[model samples]
Target chain A: MSNKLLLMGDEAIAQGAIDGGLSGIYAYPGTPSTEIMEYVQNTKQTAELNIHRKWSANEKTAMEAALGMSYAGKRAMVCFKHVGLNVAADAFINASITGVNGGLIVVSADDPSMHSSQNEQDSRFYAKFAMVPILEPSNQQEAYDMAYFGFELSERLNVPVLLRITTRMAHSRAGVQRREGKPQNSLRLPSDPRQFVLLPSIARKNYRKLLMGQAAMEIESEKSSFNELISGNNKSLGIITTGIAYNYLVENYPDQKSPYPVLKICQYPIPRKQVEELYNSCNKVLVLEEGYPIVEEQLKGYLNTGKPVHGRLDGTVPRDGELNPNIVAKVLGMDVAEGQPIPDVVKNRPPSLCQGCGHRDVYEDLNEAMKVYGTGRVFSDIGCYTLGALPPFNAINSCVDMGASITMAKGAADAGLVPAVAVIGDSTFTHSGMTGLLDAINENSPITVIISDNSTTGMTGGQQSSATGKIVDICRGIGVDPNHIRVVTPLKKNHEENVRILKEELAYQGVSVIIPQRECIQTFARRKKSEKKESND
Target chain B: MKNDIILAGVGGQGILSIAAAIGLAAVNSNLYIKQSEVHGMSQRGGDVQSHLRISDKPIASDLIPEGKADMIISVEPMEGLRYLPFLSNSGWLVTNITPYMNIPDYPDINEILAKVKSLKHHIAIDADSIAKEAGSSRASNIVMLGAASLFLDIPFERIEEGIRQLFGKKGDEVVQMNLKALRLGREFSEKNR
Candidate 1:
């Protein structure tokens, strides 16, 4: 074993992919999951190992690039945060039916509790809907091991694997066992054109093959050591826990005296036979899975016995909230000591944009520009700038998802809404907004799409966006008239100019593209530090 | 036995690092520790708190319920008062008296000081001043952590060891500054008591 290093879950996934002999990694950076791609890109071993890493235009392009690599019979991986999955869902759902020529792993780090996200949608459900295997790791070590295994399983099953990690699993640090690196898979040219072609007839055949492959996958799951049956002294109670919840259960068991047998599952399409055997062996079965009761719900249908199943659905564990060790112990009939009461600590601290942030100045200018136009005329996209929807500056009226701003603005303009403006980040514009931009330009919709170009993917930790240097040209190339396009600096000193330009574009009576360019605050800080170091050297 | 500690401070005050150090110390002592942190826009000058649960056995929940903390360590006075509800009635509060209010509309520093004085087991230290004296304002967290050590049974040596391990890679200058800050904080808390 290499030196056992304490690594964050995100870093562990990156290391796991490297150890798993991934040949290509395509990703558009988003938080929690951003570190995975960044780690792989920065590691000295990447070039030594001949790994191909690139920041794609958007999640869809990233997903497609990964699929293309898998088509060449090489291990490929794509990563994005929870919402990025929405941008790539079209390709993601179809890829499940299309299967794969080689190993393919799609990692979606779900942000629970709305941390750095608009919503806390579980990605495991997406995996289930796509009829693919999903793996959720509880800690850094599991994240590493599962990611490695996810690749092998994907190749073995001839299907894409979804490795779903939550914010806790992505950011938390734990000691991980290092392993000797595996050699990259030998490349193989496409043997049959029909495999790549996803016509209805071919897709139907592949879909049936997917169904036929489920039984074998379940058998594989049963034999896999990742899911274990940990038996204790008590036969009356049993606990079925998976992912981080398993860690919570193990940690909460007082005196290590768990009265029940625990079938700890970290992989899914859960080994139903193992769950059944454990269920049959115990008097009462309790499910301790996180996110949704995917395991608990599935076990209910398969069980023939009269034993009652307890879990999220039954309210034994919380159905809507994140789990902790104390909650798990209470459900297990353990008497844990309650600590002293906490005093009232009331302080209302609202989220604020960073000091000297370019988004701040842009929002100020945009608000002024919109005031001239009318109220409720602006639609905003996701990014660091989404905070504009909050106090002091309510420049944006709607923010649903990536690229929603452009489409929503188009919709509002078509309905004769005056001075419709869509504000999106440069990264977001490439992610999913560009298509809507094209639509607006082609249809000559009377709207203004403001691309807040911070020269990076600002919200999710500053990963480079594919359209970093080409947004203006791309807009013009897509039939947006150059005369109608405007670019401005989102600096406090340039506030008046930015507002003036925005107002002019808003009144253009046609699709006008506005590019507000600036550097993200964090990126700017990092660059300053690097420059200082260079000067010192 | 479970030990619930609430570490609170304004964002950017290194409250998370202090909690992380405590969690690492507990883990090193052969105990099971579960830690949950709030992440979002909070790191940008908002109120920040981390829940650190250390037990000889397993911990069940990530959050310590209201009024259940064995100890509350506040890096800032206002931030400490904000998390007081998590502290047991008789629980100890170790905080820096200095006010580091990032947002406008902050309560008067005198009022905050008066409120803290009402607690039975309150130990206030001028951690910011100590850190400044130590030649690095960033070491205020270390100093506050040092002051909090007086109320806990965890050895000063363990904390010293943890600090060393955390700053060891940063080089000798940082290591020396932090060690000085920690020792000064410990001395200030002891003298006040």
Candidate 2:
């Protein structure tokens, strides 16, 4: 029987990891990458195989935990969005140096055009900086195949492999044929006693080993089936495509035949031999990459290669955003008829907090309270509450990275922006706000911190939050006065009371945390539905 | 045969269910399918769309090229117009007449309807009423899918089986309600078109 299933690219990666004998999959929820872990968590195969699937507090914790699993001689995979890589950079770079006893694949889903992200930073640069092999899947099938291939490559080279994907590659669905399941590796420790230790003397040896492995990694990229040079008769213009960009190129050529010789590179390390061959044969080259112009920039260094290489830098492609078949068709000089301009009658509909959302109530109360304190004092973190910066409320002043709310508020307070406030979600607070809270307590930084406790992550589809029932204890543990750490239910009826509590906290000279405790409306609705089903039964 | 469709709706409107039924049907027919979905922040209440492509040959891009979509099946009238740029000149616009008025500045219902009605090829149905008539208003997405199934290259029976397979875990009652919703929608389209 054919074991074919229709799966999203994220689900394909999860199923691939399972079939590839994954012992554990660790992640902190973020878009385009969240579904990978969610799929693993919900799948029957993982439960039957006893695979460890749990949400980590943050990307750094997830990366370190996956590294630790690899240290135990069991295959582990860590998944996160592109920006999450910034949080895990320290551990990620060092992991390459420490290498691995078991296979480790770090899946970083990049969001081009800022789809669900604050920025459009490509993850391939990080892999290049760490000098590890990178697997960029061009489609759903490749996304699945890469997991199995990445694990083997990771084990073969004794290094962690980076599997990079963009939003389209992660969220798109296609049919994927499954491979036979492999048995999980039994629990065992690394053979080298001092391998994971980063003592300076050992570090030098590890760094040298990583630096030396670049050649072998390059060799692997050259021979990888994922990266290939398709022959074409026309040699006037060659093309180099990475990741899903290759799909756009093929999409323009429906016959699956481009007139120009194309170097389809889904593996990193440049695969210099194939690239050089293509570059040498064609009179000019066009580089197509999804996110950044890493390949284009590399191919055209400070001293330009005489052959006119064109890409983002040269304006052959629009400098930013994702590539679609229309863009490729236009670039290839093919006529494209984009149907019609949307009539002006269509109004823009931005995402807003749900009507009954606790975050909406909190923002309403916060906006009302902030009227007395004046505006431009609220620093918010990444979450659904970040939506407070928009629309009817327009409450928050800044929406930076996760956990930046508290620290930025403290810094602003230090700069004499007195009565500065930080509003963060419960999940984000536990993710990184706890440390900033500790800092505020140590010096008594006069910043009012509002931990909008929704009891679930609320953003990225309500994953289990580590701070679900422990926010009060955590605040008390962090040395904030019990009296100052007030809690309130964010509801319409309690609006005045919540505002009074907020005013008290803002008046305090020391650190104060006001947690508005309410269940997320979406999750609450889901619970009600399930509960009603149970009652009906 | 190849068919590229754009499923459009407001988030939380159950458009993914519509995409799931069609995807399942395409898979059952042994057609190559690729569907690109929107997730994360915009899913709160913003406009959400899915690019669904099915072909006898292997599909390449997850997104349909501009002006290449064979049909746009939207659960909301205004949401359908949002993807007009992706529709081919001859593409069909199958949308529900329901106005998901989450936004403050939603256009007049008649204005949106006039725009939809002005299209060369379009099917605007009161899927909510049809679904309710079929025993469940929650199956409006399935109704929208069925209204669109007329233009889809796949067989009608395949789509019925697809809905059955999709709602099977929810029990036979739910499946039967959705199947009834599907038939009512197809009936409405057959009468009107």
Candidate 3:
């Protein structure tokens, strides 16, 4: 008997890793990827299978921890969104040179169209830069099968594999078949004792080895069973699809019959043979890729291609935004009913802070305190408070990356933007804001840093934050003057005191951190329910 | 048989719980299901939706096609109407008339109901009052699901069993309250019919 369960793409990866003998899954919470680690943590499989699953302080730490597990000769999987990859890039780029004893797979979930992200950066580019093999699955079953087989492939290739998925694949659910369980790798060190060590003498040789393996990696791609060529009756148009884009391409042809040759590419490195065959077979090619036109560019060549290549760069399909079945249908010259435009009565309803949230109190008071300083002085980081840029409050000015608020505020302060204030969240403060605070303290940048301590990662479904119960100590230990490290409960009752403290910190010259301490209302509500249940029992 | 439903509501309005109920029922009937949810930053009091597709055969795409949804089950009137583009021309629209007004520019309550009534196949009810009468107002999403269940091709017993399996952890009293809310909603729709 076989096992079939309805699982999201992220859950499929988690289950695949579990079935594939994953030793550990280390990751910081982020969209479309957070559920991967959460699934393992809440599963009985982790306990019975002796898998290590825990939330790390940040993506960089998580990446390094996965690398450490790989160093001990155990299979490891690190999952994160595209931006989190930016945080972990330092560790990722080096892992290519250091190679691995056991298999290591980095699953980067890209949010195309900026769904809950700052940018729609393609992670395949990162994988290409790192000079690693990439497995881009096209469906939920493929997502599962790739993870089930990805570890072995990584070990065989002796390099980390990048499994890139978009928001659609990660969040969507479909039934996935399971494979037989495998035993975890026994403890073993790398054959080269100094391989992991990045000393120049050993690294130079390792770099040469990595570069030498590129041709072999390309051969592996050409031989990958995931890559396929489907022949049709007619050869007027050839279609090249990678990852989820294949689903959309096939969706246009319900009976799976089209009058065009199709090269469905799930594994990367272009699979030169398959591309050459398709290009030689068809008159023109339509490249369907979710993100950048990387494949089209390569196929088009520097001087020009043999056949006209049509894609995002050529305006065959819109360069920006997501590719849907409707968009695919339009591209295929099929009839698509255009949905009516949104009624003018339906105004823009952007995301806002929850009612009675502690962040609301913090913002309400901060707006009052900054009335004299005017607008555009507050630089915010990613979190629920970023919504303060909306109407009712109109509080914060800028929100660049995860921890750019403090550093940006410092730079502005140096550039004569007086009273430049930085607003950040509890989880975000610990994520990357701490280092920037240290920099500000060292230079004594004239800025007031407000750390809205909500006791949990409020924006991401209230995950337990690393800064919980240690925000004050963290501020004090980070070299901020102890006397100036102010803490207040962000409540409607304490609005006056909160505003007064904000005023005081804004007036102060040196760096000051005002932590508005309050447990997130959602988590608090959950706690109350559990507490009441316990009392009744 | 196939059912494509768009479960709609504001973030934190318990639309997922409603989707879970239908998903559990669909799975128990041995039907294939694909549910795509909105996660991350937009979930913070923003418009949120889930596309739930159930079929006897294996499902292809996680998302339903435009103007092809069989029904729209929503916890808020505005949220339900927001997804009219996804509904087929003859699709059923079941929604709560209550406005969870977190936005500053929320429209007049009568205006929303009038628009909903314009649909040939629609059921607009105040799920909040019915849920409050049953037990807890948090079960309003369940009520909306019950009203929508009248139009689903799936059986009613499966949905009732689904509620039992979904709310099994919350104890009998809470479960009974939700069950009452579900039945109350069904009775109201039947009375209107």
For residues A93-167, could you state the per-residue lDDT of candidate 2 as single tens digits? 999999998899999999999988999999999998998999999988899999976788999998999999999
Off by over 4 Å in 3: A1-3, B133-135, B172-176, B187-193
Top-scoring candidate (lDDT): 2
Which candidate leads the pack in DockQ? 2
For every prediction, compared with the true complex, DockQ reads 0.33, 0.77, 0.54
lDDT of each residue in A1-537, candidate 1, tens digit only: 114565667888989999988999988887767888888999999988889888988888889999989989999999998888988999999888878887999999887667677777778889888888888886667789987777889988988999988877776654578777888888886577687688989888888999999887788778877788887778888888888887767765545446678898877788888888897888888888767777778777665346788888878888775676667778777675554333334457666678888888888888888775578888998777777887778777887988899999999989989678899988888878888988898889999888888888776667777778999889988899999888888888888888888878887889998888888888999999989978977
Could you give candidate 2's per-residue lDDT for residues B66-119 as a string of tens digits?
A: 898999999999999999999999999999999999988999999999999999
Categorize the docking of model 2.
medium
Error of 2 at A129 (Å): 0.7
For model 3, fnat equals 0.51
Better of 1 and 2 by DockQ: 2
Pairs of residues at least 3 apart in sequence or in different chains that clash in candidate 3:
none
Worst-scoring 10-residue span by lDDT in model 3 chain A: A338-347
Show pairs that collide, candidate 2.
none
